[model samples]
Target: MKKTLIAAFICSLSATPALAKTEIQFWHAMGGALGEKVEDVVAGFNASQNEYQVNASYRGNYNDTMTAAIAAFRSNQQPAIVQVYEVGTATMMAAEGAIYPTYQLMEEFSKGFDQSDYLSSVTGYYADQNGNMLSMPFNSSTPVLYYNKGAFAKAGLPDRGPATWAEMEEFGQKLLDAGYACGFTTAWQSWIHLENLSARHNVPFASKENGFGGTDAELQFNGPVQVAHIEKMGEWQKAGIFSYSGRTNEGSAKFYSEECGMYTESSAGYAGINANAQFEFGVSSLPYWDNAIETPQNTIIGGATLWTLRGHDDDAYRTVAAFYDYLSDPVVQADWHQFTGYLPITYSAIKLSEEQGFYEQNPGTDTSIKQMTSVEPTENSTGLRLGNFPQIRGIIDESLESVWNGTASAQEALDRAVSRGNEQLRRFERANR
Candidate 1:
């Protein structure tokens, strides 16, 4: 009887399961198709390992996610990771004690991380003054031209996109003459027309190297080049060659609906435009000012990156680092890039895509990569690292809306934006200091 009871106890002990895997929460802003891709990436990671499980929560858009994460952190319930848009870089950088630098985390936990493998143009935007990466470059992208090939063919315009602003204007005029609703429209007017325009022209968007040098930097976007460009856009609006779509990617609908022949938007616009457009379309490099004194420089990055928040356990940090390393795999990076139209963040990923002939098979898909990496990034072209940039973008949007609606001239409107933007910068400087 004693031997039978001992055998039963041994059997029960052996049948017990092991402990659950450590859970790591990731709060992000991606939604829709992009959100699905995020889930796939996380699932792949979870399947590849048994020690950690990442739970991804869609917190809303970029602004909303940032706001939510900030609230969560203050309440000591922050996620292990948060994805913040480029506009929030300065804000994140300012939150020194609340976040973990990705470089240190990678070095301490990701045994295979190679900082040198990352593309400079993509990493530079999120790096410190000494070039140490502060966040993982998850979905870096730049503005590009998305045009309706069918509309261009109907207008007797070049099937390929225009290379210069003058060419773009001429194309717009021809498209309008051919009975299109409008020649062109844009999605992110402030980003595409002003911020990137200044960078592409190697002109200063703000003092102190576009605010990368210091918080004391003031707005310098109201200069002659910017004024001339805005004036030209206004002229196009008046001539019916350009239509003013509502702010915040509202113009994408206009282009996809074939109301406009051309659109300047984030290269990530590919997925949505491809999904919606009935007519054939092509992606191309952003048009530049051909008459500028200096040749057009590289455009700046616009997408968000993943940031590791502080206060997590060592185990969670290690898991977060492992996930970061997983995300940096060449195959994973290339798949994400091709799937979403974001630039490949790592050189290995770009080379892998080339090895697979992804670019050749899909014409014009490499437009964003070429536009970003063709030239060495100058100080002006590296990127804007301004604080309170979201608010500044709002101010610029409001001011430019007045310009588009003929309530004010471009120069007058831009002057007002600069004046208003400078005050915001001052506030950020004070708060951060």
Candidate 2:
């Protein structure tokens, strides 16, 4: 009887299942110092509630993260949340039944829905025609002018940052004359040169809502303003006013080492920059074209948003929604903005920072936000919403590379880039429609 009772108890215990935590896996592109901030946000969310545990994973860069999510979704092993870059907006939207819209997710799963809390400019980009926001804008940023103070001093130029592209060109030439290897270099050349440059000069990169309204829109990057800027940059190149760093921001190493006078990169570059710079530096509004039609419209956001993936259980969705709420909390959001160079996606976070004198203490840190909000975002100023934008950007990269290397003239390259990019859009439009 004793052995029987003992055996029965052991069997009962063996048959019991382990208690499961409502697991929420978040796949993101943030790595290096950026990955650490992501983990910190996840940890904060996990600690805020025991009902849900958010597990953050770094999947690679933006493209890699999206590719992994698609594969995972196809295999029914997708995470509750996946962070995708701004370029992936249309692709994510086209992936029918794959993502749960953030506004809808907030209502279906959480009590923490506050659409009014988000910045109008940031959230408006990921929204639909009727102004319904889809993804939660998490790490929104714009390109800024990052100048090496040391380079300016060495060039005998005032330690002040240039306010216009013409001024920037002069400054760049001065640095080159002073024996600097490359006076300027940048990452995301298309983003800096074409998209942001277009908007900052109040020109359109495409028609039909910057490719948002319809996928059939063609790239108009060869317009007079764009062509002029490209040709000017090309002329500067031949004159040694600018230098090629590489295809991508990989050559951004020159800027980080204080070799370049000015570097145009995403504002999210702050963490790596703050850690690596051997000399003092500052940021300014991205230099604009002076005579180009009404300059300083608004810069488009870069970075990514937290896209909630489907095919997960209710428990998983609930956890993901709760994590989003946690990330959107005022204190949490404010800390994120200050800690990273990313813009606070919420209005309250900006107000809180102002109340706390965060911006007052840190001059130039708010330039991106100010530049974005300086004017009401018309259809043109809001942001780009292109299909296969990453691929199109690559075409631009090739065109620009040719111009820089003297293989193709600016107008010729841009015209060709537009033609090839429109073909890709035609493909996307056919499939989506």
Candidate 3:
């Protein structure tokens, strides 16, 4: 009778099945080391829980990933979560019924979630009119001055980045005299040169407070401040003080190669710059036009945010909220911010980082943070909300390239870009309205 009972118990145990974990799909634009870090983050979350498994896919670069998500949404096969660049905020906001607002998702599913916990400068870019956050802030960055310390020493200049455009010019001349092939170059010419430049100078990039007011807003970046700045860059190009690397981050290579003595790029570029540069580098605040403003205002961000899409079931969304909650933990955020050189999104994360001595040990790592928080954001510095912004950026890129190549004057190029960009705004308004 004992043998019979043991056999029956074994058979019952063999008949039972293991529970399956719910699967969540995540699409992202991060590649290379950042991509590896994304995978590790997902693995950490998966290991921490048994109820849900997140499968993160590297779709491509920012534009490609966004395109893929839109295509997938149209096919009814979209991922549960997608990372969209900061510039895409307006387009995503205009996509009615496509997004599951982060505020609503967290309020409904996650406990102890406070929108106030996030940095207002970071969240304000992704928030609605009522100040409700639409997406989760991830990898936020602002442009800063990156200088080759070795070159600065060689040039007999001070061991610091230029505080104003005039100082930058003087530093550029000294760098050139020090035998650097290029004195300075910048990534994302439109973002760093015109957009943030205008904001720092308290000038409008477009009317309607840079389109935060409504879709009827028009381009106003061709103002005197913008035109004069571009004209100065054009002159620098002629003088070999400024090299036109490209419209995007191709300029980083110039800095990495030590061909350019100084670079104006995203703070997140620290990861690559630190990894590749054989010599030491120092970071500082983005240069401003002292003549335009008595003091520089806060610069805008340039990285991406994570947006939850519609069409996912409640269970999947619950898992997403859980994942987001995990991601928002001060420890987790501090780790990500330290590893990636992105901004710590929440005050707690910043405090945790400070307590960890990450900034003190890293030296210039806190420059971007200080540049962002040093001044309260003005209406011009709050953030841009232009529609079809990606396309508008392309227009501005072409126009700037024309100036760099000496084919058009600053006034002519900007006027043409403004005209062309306004057409895109009109088209975006018609489609979304």
- On lDDT, the leading prediction is 3
Stretch of 10 with least lDDT, candidate 2: 14-23
- Candidate 2 structure quality by residue, lDDT tens digits, 1-433: 9999999999878765344568778899988777898888888777776777888899988888899999999999898889999989988888768989988888999896888878888988898877778999999999988888887888899867888888988898899889887777787889888988887877788998787777778888899989898898898888767777776677568888767778888887776677888888888888888788554788888888989887878888888788888888889999999889899999888999999999888777898899888888877767788888889988999999999989998899999999999998998888888
> Can you list the residue pairs that collide in candidate 1?
none
- C-alpha lDDT values of all predictions: 0.92, 0.85, 0.93
For model 2, what is the error of residue 210's alpha carbon versus the real structure, in angstroms, after optimal superposition? Answer: 0.4
Count of backbone collisions within predicted model 1: 0
Give candidate 2 misplaced runs (Cα > 4 Å). Answer: 1-19
How big is the positional error of residue 220 in model 3, measured in Å on the Cα after superposition? 0.7
- Report backbone clashes per prediction: 0, 0, 0
Candidate 3: list runs displaced more than 4 Å: 1-18
- In model 2, the Cα lDDT at residue 428 comes to 83
TM-scores across all candidates? Answer: 0.96, 0.94, 0.95
